[model samples]
Target chain A: MISTFIRHELKAFWRSKNTGKSIAVRIVMIFLILYLFGCILLAGIGMDKILEIAFPNDDLVKSFCGIVLIYFLFDLFMRLQLQELPTLRVQPYLHLPIKRNTLVGYLAITAVFSMFNLWPFLLFLPFIFKIIAPDSGIIVALAFVVAIIGISVFNNYLALYLKRKSNLNGWIFLITAAVLILIVIADFWWHFYSLHNISYAFFGRLLTMPILAIIPALLGIVMYYFNFLYLKQNLYLETLTARKVKIYKSNTDIPFLSRFGTIGDLAANEIKLVFRNKRSRSSLIIGLFFMFYGLIFYTNKSLGQGWYLFAGMYMTGAFVVNYGQFMFGWQASHFDGILVSKINFSDFVKAKYLLFTTVSAISFVLTIPYVYFGWHVLLVHFVMCVWNIGVTTTIVLFFANRNFKRIDLSKSGTMNWEGVGASQLLLTLPLILTPYIIYTPFAVFKHPDIGLALLAVTGFIAILTRNYWIKQLEADYYSKRYRIAEGFRNK
Target chain B: MIEIKNLKKIYGNVTVVDIPHLSIAKGESVGLVGNNGAGKTTLFRMILDLILPESGEITSNGEIVAGHEHWKAYTASYLDEGFLIEYLTPEEYLYFIGGLHQQSRAQVDETLTALGDFFNGEILNRGKYIRDLSKGNQCKVGVASCLLQNPQLLMLDEPFANIDPSTQFRLKNMLKDANKSKGVTTIVSSHDLNHITDVCDRILLMEKGVIIKDIATSSSTLSELEDYFGVGQTVGATPVVKIDEEENH
Candidate 1:
């Protein structure tokens, strides 16, 4: 049954749309994994020597043991953000004469194939072979390997269970991320206590009493059972249907945008889409998070001024690049109605322009506190704000007409690449590189002010003729309406 | 109300919608009947300008449907769930549609009140997004929203496909009343022969993207279609092809 399920999964993946692109991405990902493995292998082989040189007074094993907790914590954080739920068509099996336990076991076992389970062994196995084997003999080294595998498995199931729980209630996800952030801040910034001491207390003793390695292995078993029971209880199709939260019907419109007539109503719909859907709503949250991006480069007095230029552009145009790249994709779900509705193409384009500019303007204002970095930073941000409103907005919308993939708005937003196409990838080139092309030559010649002025002038001219750009976009969209509608209806 | 000239939509090698010329006049109650893959949807999509034809044109109200804004004013269509914005509640969705046609909130509320029986008290004020509604309720919402605009040219792909029998009867009566009172140029497609014949003044029978029969509705019209479909007769393709050839004259 498991083999048949796996075969079905392979068939579904191969027959999916854009199968060629998915295969290409997989090949690239394979090379990346191998490269990371090489780095970890080298790090493990040379850890004993490096530890002695860096900490001459401390024991090498103690020093190594101190960082294991930190490594797993970071691993857990990355898994929370990057790991995808292993998808199995559990629906068909639910009706057949199959035990629920077998299905849940298949899901849990397939999840172990993830890279998170391999990372620890890649980094630690060589160390145990070269150092622990000779120093404490092979049995203790073997015990440590067993413990490492056990803890790695523990983190895998635990992360999967937490993520599954979080999907049911978003607040659980938010609180988990917050708690993780607080731990990092407390350990690194406040220095109120030390995770190193706690880690060493448990691991350093393993060298003396290798029999104690059984604890981590036992913990991994407990975690697997926990995940199994949780999943078995919640895997019903009915439980997955509706959000458990009670909803209040509040039929309201954006009071300010409603004044623009139909255009306002269109923009209002777009606004509600951005706030209501998971994929779009996160784009807004992430854009706001990046408003603090300047703090990274600005506070580093040793970094080059070029870094600030990059930061300034990103902070001001975060909303534009994040939300604008998806363009008409937000409406791909109901594009048929959009095509048939009594709406003018020009008004539709204008409403998009209004949405982009409004978000950019709000982001720009939120980023103003970064002026404490320098007046120079403020000028760069202000210039990019204009550039975003003018050139970036036009470019984003132009490429938007070319994006035809439909996005499922109900899915989780973290790593789902639904509506992405070649256009979104190519769009980043001009969005980031165009400013550098114009700015680099002037800065190289030591006339940096001229570069800023030229960029601002170009943006100012583009903003001045927003209507002309809107008309051009309207014409482009008119020709692609049928194709876009057809693409969205592919399901 | 709608015109098609040499319209053709080909998928790879299949001519999905190959109509030489078809015209729907104002205030005509036209019903399109066909089995699946008979190009009913493709033709409706072309008329709505949601799908472009490779070799012809659809002109709604004398304006080219491809790149113009004039035709949408008098025409409103609901082909499938694609016509709905599922994130909003039914009431909110209705209000949004009404606002597009420049209908005020009070006017929309009045319309919803009139269709309360059609809704059967499960739609409005239910605090449910259209996505969460049952399939039949979603259909009711889709059809009712189209009515909110009172468009002269209204189209629904299958209004009675999943609806209950009683609601289907109410909808048939409501559509007949709408056509008589407002002179709405309504076009609907359905597989249900009894309801379509009861509601439509004329029926167009399609087979393999071709209109094989065009007949004015009469007491015998339903039985003829049933025979062509081989529903209550000896099942074979012979009688259907004979009727097609006989109707060509």
Candidate 2:
């Protein structure tokens, strides 16, 4: 049964419409995984030497034991973000002769085959052989290895359970994140208790008495059973279909936008599109998170002024670059209606301009607190804001005309390459490099202020000549609209 | 109000729409009937300027449709689910479309109240996005939005394919009333011979990418189309092609 399921999965992957693109992504991912595992293996082999150097006065084995729990804690955090639940088309098999328990058991077992489960062995196995075997004897070392495997399994099922619960009620996700943050703060900032000492107390006993290792193994069994029960209870088609009929509240109208007329209406709809869909909502969240980007460079006093410009540009314009690159593709689902409706193409272009400027302006205002780093930081962000509105908006929309792939808005954005095309990849070049090209010569000659002035002037001039750019965009859109519509139709 | 001149759209080697000249007059209720792959959709797309033709032009009210924004002021179309903004609720979608035509919210609500029976109580105030609605209900939303536009030119492709029987009757009446009362030029394509014969004053039969027959609707129109399609015939009976010759003569 498992072999048949694996064969079907392989066929689905190979037969998918985006097989060529997925194959390329897979090759890149494989190289990345190998590189990460290679680093972990080297770290494992040299663990004793590193421990001795870092903790010169403390016992090496005790320090290593203290780090084990910390490693797993970090492992659990990473797993929560990266792990995917194992899904099978069990509907077809539910009415067949196969037992429901067998399907649930299959899902639970396959869920264990993830990179999170493999990283522990790569990072801990060599340490176990070199340090623990001769000192604690082979049997004790084996028990320690069993404990590591047990804890890894426990973490796997626990993360999957929490993720499933969160899917049913979203507050579970927020509460889990809050609890994790509180744990970090209580241990590190409040000094309420010490996790390192607690970790040593648990793992150090395994080194002396091998029987204590059974505790983690037992915990692993309990989590596995919990997941199995959860799956069996919620396996019915009724539960699956019933969860999708969520009661949606109508979006309230923004009275302020009514003053702008049709352009305002279009922009208001775009805002709802961003908030209502999973992929677009995540994109907006990521843009908001990038407001902290200046913290990395602005804190470093050694960097040149040009580096500040780069960070400031990114901080204020992240949403413009992130969301604007897929401008027309976001509307691919209704592009036909847009083409034939009572809307002028120029008004459509104006609405996009309106959305970009509004978002960029809000991003700039949020970065005003960065002036505490230096007044220069705020000045640079202001210039970048103008550049984003006038220059980057045009570049992004220009590249948008070439992107025809339709985005499925229902899917999450993390690691999703659904609407991505070569145009999206190429768009990043001019966006990042164009400012540097204009700013480099002045910085090299020690006249950095002149470069900033020149950039602001260029942006100002573009703003003044906005009508010309709008006409150019309208023409470009008309020429490529047919091809874009055709591509969208194919999907 | 729509004119096509030598309009041809080719997909690789096959020409999908190759009409030399086809014109729709004001207030004309036209029915387009054809089998699968008969270029009915491609022709509609060309007329709406969604698909650029290989070697010709389409015009609305004597202005070229390509690169012109004025035509959109009077044209409204619903070809498929692609025409719907699926994330919006039915009421929200209707209001959005109505807003484009400068219709007030009260006006839109009044129109919805009138369309309540056509919607069959499944659409408005349902607290469901259009994407979550069933196919038949989604079609009702699409058709209702087109009506809200109050467009001088309205086009719909296969609107009856996914609708219920009673709703189909209501839609036929709506199209007829739009043509007679408001002078709205409607182009509807359907596979149902009975519905097309009842709703349309003129019917155009398409084959491959060409119009094989064009006739005024009469008592014999439905049977003539049925004969060409070989409906109610015994197994292995070929569709009659002589109707094309007769129509040409």
Candidate 3:
């Protein structure tokens, strides 16, 4: 039965509509995994030498034992971010004669095959064989290997359980994150307790008493049973596969947006789209993270002044570049309704412009405190903000028409390349280089202020002539609406 | 009033919708009945200007729908789940559609009150987004939003397929009211012969991308459609006993 299930999964992957894209993504992921495992292999082989250099006073084996807990803790955090839940199409088999335990067991067992489970071995096996074998003979080394396997299994199941619980009730994720953060602060800053001592207290004994390793193996079995029982009880379609109704307070309206009438309504609907969907919300969060781009360039004085423009452009325009790259694709789900509704194409284009302008303006405001780096940084951000609103916004919207791939907004944005196309890759080049094209000539002749003025003035001009750009975009959209709608409907 | 002129949509050599000339007059309630792949949806899409026709064009009130936006002001359609903004709650989606037509919140609330019977208390004020709603409830939300527009021309494709029997009865009354009193031109495609015959004044029977029959609805319309679909033969024919006997053995 398990073999049959695996064959079905393989066929599903190969027969899926986006198999080519998924294969490309898999190839890239294989290379990345190879690189990461190679680094871990090297680290494991030289663990003794590295630990000896770092801690000259302590014994190398003891130091390695102390950091095992730390490594697993960090591993848990990474797994929470990166590990995907193993999902099978259990709906088709639910009414069959097969028992429910078999399906749940299949899911739980296949989940253990994740890279998170393997990384522990690549990081610990060589060290275990080289250091523990000669010191305590073969039995203790084998015990250490068993302990590593037990701990890896425990962490793997624990992460999957937490992730599933968090999907049903999101507060689990928040509470877990808060607890992890508190732990880090307590250990690193407050000196409340030492994870190192606790780790060694357990693992240090395993050096002499090989039988002590059975504790983690037992704990791993307990965690596995916990997962199995949880899955067995919640195996119904409603609890397992169906999206639960989120109990959100019904307050999506923006009172101020009502004043703009139809255009405002369109923009307000888009704002709701961003906040209410997983993919768009994560992209917004990522854009907010890029506001810290100036910190890297400004603190490093060796990088020179030219890099500041690039940083400022990215800082203020990240949301525009990130969100606007898939402008129409975001609305692809409802493009049919949008086309047949009372919305004008020009107003549709303007609503997008309105959204980009508002977000870019807010981003610029957030970066104002960076002026402490020097007034020049603020000047650069201001010019870039203008350029982003006037020029970058239009460029992003123009490329949006070329992106025909539909994006499923319910999916997570991290590592999801659903709507990515060649246009997205090419979009950044013009967004970064357009201002440079106008400014480089003046800066080359030792008149940097003239370059800044030119960029700002060009942006101001574009802002003044936005209606012309709107007309151009409307024409472009009319010519491509059929193809765009056709692509969206295929999904 | 909608007119199709030599409209043709082909997918890889299989013509999905091919019409030489067809026109729906103002204030006409038309029913389109076809099996799957008979081009009912493809025709509706072309009329909405979502799909471009290969040979000709669709005109709404003398304006070519392909490049014109005028028809959208009075035309409201709900073809499938794609027409719905699934993230929004039912109330939010209705209000958003209302706001598009410049309907005030109070006016929209009034309309919602009028639709209370059709909604059957399952749609409005539900805390769930449309995506989380069951397919039947989603159908109610889609149809109710279309009615909220008070449109001069309304189009719905397979609206009866996923709704409850009670709501289907209520929907038939609503369609009658829209056509009889308000004179709203409605185009609905359905697989339910009884419901389509009850709701529409004119029925167009299509097969393999061509309309095989167009007739005014009357007493014999239901049986005629049943005969065309071969469902009427089962009424007079002898029951097949071999399968039941074999199963018993």
| Per-residue lDDT of model 2, residues B1-249, tens digit only | 888889888989999888899888988889999999999998988888887889999989999988777887787788999889888888778888988988999999999999989998999887888888998899999889988877898898999999999999999999889988998998999999999999899999999999999899999998899888975685356766665766787
The 10-residue segment with the lowest total lDDT in model 2 chain B: B234-243
The alpha-carbon deviation from the true structure for residue A442 of candidate 1, after best TM-score superposition, in angstroms, is: 2.6
Whichever of 1 and 3 has more TM-score, that candidate is 3
lDDT over C-alpha atoms for residue B140 of model 2 = 92
**Top model by lDDT, which number?**
3
Ranking by DockQ: 3, 1, 2
Fraction of true A-B contacts recovered by candidate 2 = 0.70
How does candidate 2 fare on TM-score?
0.90
Better of 2 and 3 by lDDT: 3
Q: After best superposition, candidate 2 residue A214: deviation in angstroms?
A: 3.5
Candidate 2, residues A317-385: lDDT per residue as tens digits? 898889887778788888887888878877888889888999999999999999898798899999999
Query: Clashing residue pairs, candidate 2?
Result: none
Which digits, one per residue and each the tens of the lDDT, describe model 1 over residues A1-491? Answer: 88987898798767765343554445544676688888887887888887788778888888888878788888888888877667435777788888888888887788898877888888888888888789999988988898888889899988888777766776777898899889888988999778888788878888888888999999999999898887788887644333445556566668989888888888888888888787888988888888888888888889876776678778888878998887777788788887778777888888888887888888788888887877788888888888888888898889888988787787656745566677777888888888888888999999888988888998999999988988888788877877787778875
Top candidate when judged by DockQ against the true structure? 3
Q: What fraction of the true interface does each of the listed models get right, in terms of native contacts kept?
A: 0.68, 0.70, 0.74
Model 1 DockQ vs. reference: 0.56
Off by over 4 Å in 1: A18-57, A73-82, A163-194, A233-235, A239-252, A302-304, B231-249
lDDT by residue (B1-249, candidate 1, tens digit) is 788889888989999888898898899999999999999998888888777788899888888887776878878788888789988878878888898899998999999999999999989988788888888999999899888888898899988998999899999998898898899988999999999999999999998898889889999998899898975677444654445666687
* Number of colliding residue pairs in each model: 0, 0, 0
Off by over 4 Å in 3: A17-57, A125-142, A167-171, A242-245, B231-240, B243-249
